[model samples]
Target: MSHKQALIIYNPLSGKRKKHSAFPILLNKLSEIGYHLTVNEINEVNNMNNPIRKACTQKWDAIFIAGGDGTVNQTIQFLAEEEFRPNIGVFPFGTSNEFAKFMRVPNNIIDVVSVIESGCITPVDLGKFGNRYFINIAAAGWLADITYETPPFLKSKFGELAYCLYFFKKLLFKKPSDNISINISDTVFSDLSLFLIMNGNSVGPLERLIDEKICDDGYFHLLTYKKTTRIKLLFHLFAKLLNLSKDLSIIQHTKINEADFMLPESISLNLDGELASVNSSYFQVLPQHLNVFGSNKNN
Candidate 1:
C-alpha cells in the first residue's frame, strides 16, 4: 500500500513542559515510521483555522491535532463543514484531554503514533450546540461561569488547577440558579441548578465524576442537578472527588439524542473549554458524524 500523507497541527503552549520537550523526538519517530508528514506549528490562536483549510485544499490522508481541547474544537469546526472530511488523528498534548480519554488514545507520544500508523478508524458521535460542534461536554450555569471567570495567567501557569481554584471560588460567592428548565425528548424537567450534557465518557482527569455509565453509545448524557444549598454542593463536590455515585442524590441523569434548555435569564455555556451563553439553547447528537482515527475500543 502507498504511504499516507499526514498533517500535524500543534500548539506549542499546551501540555506539561516535559511533554512539550518531546516534540523533536516525536517528529523523528514519525519520520522513521515512513509517513509523508507536514508539521505546522501554531503560534497565534487565530492561525488554527488557516492550517486546516490549507490541509483540506491539499492531498492529505489524515489531520493530526496535537493540542488541548480548544485546539481540537477549532479544527473540528472547520473539518465538520468540509465536503471531504479527512480522518482525524489526535496527539493529546493538552492539559485536559477529555476527548482523548474517550477515544482511549495513550498519553505517551510513541504509543499515540503507533495507534495512528495502525490505520484503524472508528465512527463516533458529536454534539451540536447552536451552530458549533463539541466532541466532549457542553455545560451551562455554574460551571460555565467558573470556567469563564478563570484567569488566563493562572491557566497558563497551573493548567487544570485553574479550573479547580475557580470552582471553589464560585462556590463561595456564586449561588446556583433555580430558574432553568430542561427538555430532553419527551421528558421535561423544571427547576434545575446546573445542566451538564456530555458526549464523552469522562469530563476531566477523573473518569467517574460525570457519568461512568454509557458514554460512546451514540447518545449524549443529560445530567441536571436540583437547586440546593452550598452545603449540598460541597457534598456533591466531595462525592465527585471520591467517585461515589450514591452522593449524587441531587443530580438527575438520563440519556437522549436531543434536548433543550430554557433559562429564565441569559446564562453562559461552556463547550469543551470555550465559553458562550444564550437565554435558550438546543442540543442534538450527530450520530457517527466524526470519523476518529484510533483503536477499536468502544469508548
Candidate 2:
C-alpha cells in the first residue's frame, strides 16, 4: 500500500516530435511524494479512455494527466462520461500545453511536478460540448479549422507560431467554414466565421487574452468573429493577441454559460486541439466541476 494512491495517465508519443521526455522525472517526483503511481502510457486515443474510466470507477485519490492538451482532453472526455470522478492534477509533458498554460502549470515538467506534489487541489470549470467535455476551450470555424490542418509535431516545436502559419495558409487558400448559425441560450446569431466557447483564462500562447478573475466564476468565456474577409481574420487574431480588443466587441469576446448550435455542414471541431464532432449540438459550463490543481487564485 502507498501513503496516497494516484492514477497517472500519460501519452508517451505526445509533445513536439516526441522530444521532451519527462516521464522519468515525473515518476521520480511522485515516488518522492509517496504516491503509488499506477501509470498508463497511451499508444492510441482510445487507450486513454479505458484507464481513466477504470480509475474514476475505483475513485483514485488523485488523477494526474501527464501529456499535452490532446491527452488531457481525451482523459476528461472519458471522466466526464463516467459517474464517479476524482480531483485532478497535471504535469505538462506535451506540446502547445495550452490547457497547462491556462492552468498556469509550469511548462517545465519538473516545475509542474513540484506543484502537484504540494497536494493543492483547486476546483476549475469544464465546458460540456454535447455529451463530450472540454477543459480549456471548444472552438469551431476558420481559425479553429487550422488546428486540425496544422501538423501536431509543429505545435510542440513552434508552439503558437504553428497556429499562425496554418491560419495564414488557410487564409491564402480562401478556406473558411460555411456560414453557420449559433444560438447562445435564447439569443440567435448568424453569419459567424468562428466561435470559441472557453473557460481557461488563456489559450495557446495568448496568456493575457483571458482575464484570470473570470476563470472560476461559474461562467464560460466566449469569443467569436463574424463573417468577414481574410484581412479581417488577421486583424482579429492581432487584436486578441495584442489586447487591442476586449470581451465585448460584437466580434471579439463575450461570456457565455450555454449555447445551442446548428452548423451548415459537419465541420470539424477543435476541443483543446483534439478533433471532435457531434451532429451540431449544445454546450454549457459545468462550474467547479472537478477538483483540479491549477492557478491558486481560483482555489
Regions of candidate 1 where Cα sits further than 4 Å from its true position? 41-49, 57-59, 210-216, 240-249, 277-280, 296-299
User: Which runs of model 2 end up more than 4 angstroms from their true locations?
Assistant: 17-19, 44-49, 156-160, 210-212, 245-252, 296-299
Q: Highest TM-score, which number?
A: 2
**lDDT per residue (tens digit) for residues 46-111 in model 1:** 444576666667747788888888778877877776666778988888777778877889989899
Give the Cα RMSD of candidate 2: 2.7
lDDT value, residue 236 of candidate 2: 68
What TM-score would each prediction reach against the true structure?
0.86, 0.89
Model 2: per-residue lDDT, tens digit, 1-299?
35677788877767665444657777888878788888877554374357777787887778888777788887887777767788788777776777777667777767777787676667888888777788887888876767667887787678668888886777788555778677876778888888887776666656656665456778887777777777766776677778787644447566888888777665777788778876448888888787887674654
